[model samples]
Target: MDLSSQNRRQVLQTLGIATGAALLSNTVSAKNAVLKAGPAFKYALNMSTIRGHRLGFIKELEVAAKAGFTSVEIWIDIFQTYLKNGGTTAEAKKIINGLGLTIENAIGFAKWIADDDTTRKAALKQLQTEMDQLAQIDCHRVAAPPFGATGLPLLNLDILADRYHAILKMGEQSGVIPMVEMWGGSENLKTISQVLYVAAASGNKNALVLLDSFHIYKGGSSVESLALVNKNAIKVFHVNDYPAGISPQKISEPDRIYTGDGVTPLKQILQLIKNPDQPVVLSLEVFNESYYKQDALTVAKTGLAKMKAVTAGI
Candidate 1:
């Protein structure tokens, strides 16, 4: 049927308005989905937690994939085993990307805070090597633990800070950021104050606060402690849950728990981070033999579930 020009124009305008309204609704739906995430669910399994499985890098990658984890943190030993067993860097990357996961940051022993020039240089070179490995995996950061320096009566805090700055300079050159972690039981930087002090000394933009759930607890710091840290300075958090029995004074470092399964103030701590948009990967970093005794998939799956439930309230 032929219609008047005015009627045709009016009908087209109505259709356009209706279509626009529907599009707006769809957009809001997608936005609500994202906000419902509230924050990213970048759950990762720490290989150390699943150490009972005795799985190496490739096997752990498979286990993580099967268990529905998109990423994991691997230790230096795992990577060494991978390369020792004819595992190529390219092959590892393919396995990771194929399963859609990341190497994340590694926990390695490096004494960048030392009094000796030779030792410091060696440490920097070691950091460089670690960064090279991370770069090959397309990872942007490495976790540097202040290990192997204890029992030496080391009073060179300034020297160590300087040394860390040098390592960070090297890391920056290679497009890697080195996060200085707080070792709860260390003589120095055993608490957040010390870690923050060292991190502040670097004065380099790449230096950051690497929060380990267990360490934070052991440091005698509370959930409120997160308020004191510069949100921008926090690189990422190493998430794990642990009971109070695992005191900072003892129990060694291999007894972290799945989130919400322990006494840690997980939700309050999570709520502490100022910005939700800043790439905070809630990596499930545990070291419990019990969790490892279960299937690696079970460990990952349970860790993810617990983390979700704990953070859900926040």
Candidate 2:
């Protein structure tokens, strides 16, 4: 039917508005679907929890998947050892995908922030190679702890910031992110404040800090300060607890216990670090010798259960 110009214009405008509304509704629905499919926080098993078992790389992944963990954080040395033993990245990726698992992040002791120019250069080269390898397996993040410079005569924070910034730029090229990790036993970057400062001073938008519940206590950092941290700055958080009897100065890696099994204020810390825009990966990391004595699959299942209990209703 023929219509007046004004009627035609009005009809077109109405149709456009309807179409836009439908599109917006669909977008909202898609987002909600994604959120519902995942939990408020993604639970991941850090391979260190079972490293003492000496399970090969593939077996470790299999054990985690059997324990009902779809996300994991692997150690770089173990992964490389698999390669040294004739495992290919393609084969690793196939195995991971087949088991419905994702490598959330990797634990590497790269001395990317060393004070020595030669050491730092070598570390960066090593990291680049590791990043390239990890990317092939769909793993895009690795821990950047103060490995070489974690002893007496602490390194300058400003210098460390620049070094971190350098590796972050390298990460840009490899689609991998190096998360500044705080080590409880390390003399440097052991506190939330120090790590946060390094990340902020990096001047890179992709700067991220990897915090650990055990480290927070071991470093003697106040748990309340976590609220001051920008949620997006933390991508993966190491979830573990420690015995209250051990002082921060005396607490060791082997002292790390499963979440809710010890005295860490996990609920408060989880709430503080929870990202509203995205799911923050809660990786269960521990080094308790007792746990190591147990079967790897049993240990993994127990860790996952403990993590879920602590984060329940958070």
Candidate 3:
């Protein structure tokens, strides 16, 4: 081959190598960018944060979506009111999907754990109806707090487990999972220990617990206890903070402040509840009257920002 032909061949080979290297570098950089774009946790807004504004069902959902939240926790009573006022489940599903929001769970006051047989039966019927409605809206979880049994004469744990198992059975039919919830002020199932005990005794693999930071403090359960829980069992966590001075016994629902604004050891608690398989839904649930008095959009935006700030770098 002539000297010029040899030189041309060498030049083309060098250019090819350079182009290949550039392409590989670009691919790696693109992958890293995609990873960074996805957050490690999911954020949600519990309608209770803006419930005081009385935005109603659809409006509250609209405000949440406008604030950049794609997930929400709704109250069953407000939802039923909307239905009574001529809103259908099909319409509710359309509006929610149109807003690009998912109802992660619903808060209901069904007396599923009551000691009275007739009352319990009626409560189960109510839950079945609510579950059917929630299923239609594509919401698969509901809070099963000890509403009626929170008063005197603490119920037996074994019986509570049986009751919870029954509720779970009903949920199976509707494709909805009932999450056993704890109320700090309640007489029964007021602590993480009690909740875990009931869940374990229920002997159902699908039994899950819904926890709240405020309720943990109210019930006098240590945030560190979260480390003992199976992270997968906590599908959705209610995030909030409490001031340093107020005693748990004195603290009320109205005292809940935005995440990271109070004295809750949120960082550690979040780390404890971190699941290796999937991101946990952190739902902001505060009922501060001050927040309720503000513009609903502003409140929703602030709550989302606070949640993001607290979960940043986790």
- Provide the lowest-lDDT 10-residue window in model 2: 32-41
What lDDT does candidate 2 reach at residue 294?
Answer: 91
Q: In angstroms, how far off is 47's CA in candidate 3?
A: 0.5
lDDT of 2 by residue, 194-288 (tens): 99999999999999999999888888899999998999898899999887788888888999898898889999999999886789999999988
- Give the range of the ten consecutive residues with the poorest summed lDDT in model 1: 148-157
Tell me, by lDDT, which candidate is best.
3
> What lDDT tens digits, residue by residue, belong to model 3 across residues 157-257?
99999999999999999999999998989999999999988988999999999999899999999888888788878999999998899998899999999
lDDT of 1 by residue, 253-307 (tens): 6677788877877777777863565656778777787776788888878877887
TM-score of 2: 0.88
**Global lDDT of model 1:** 0.76
Off by over 4 Å in 1: 1-41, 152-156
Q: Could you estimate the TM-score for every candidate?
A: 0.84, 0.88, 0.88
Off by over 4 Å in 2: 1-38
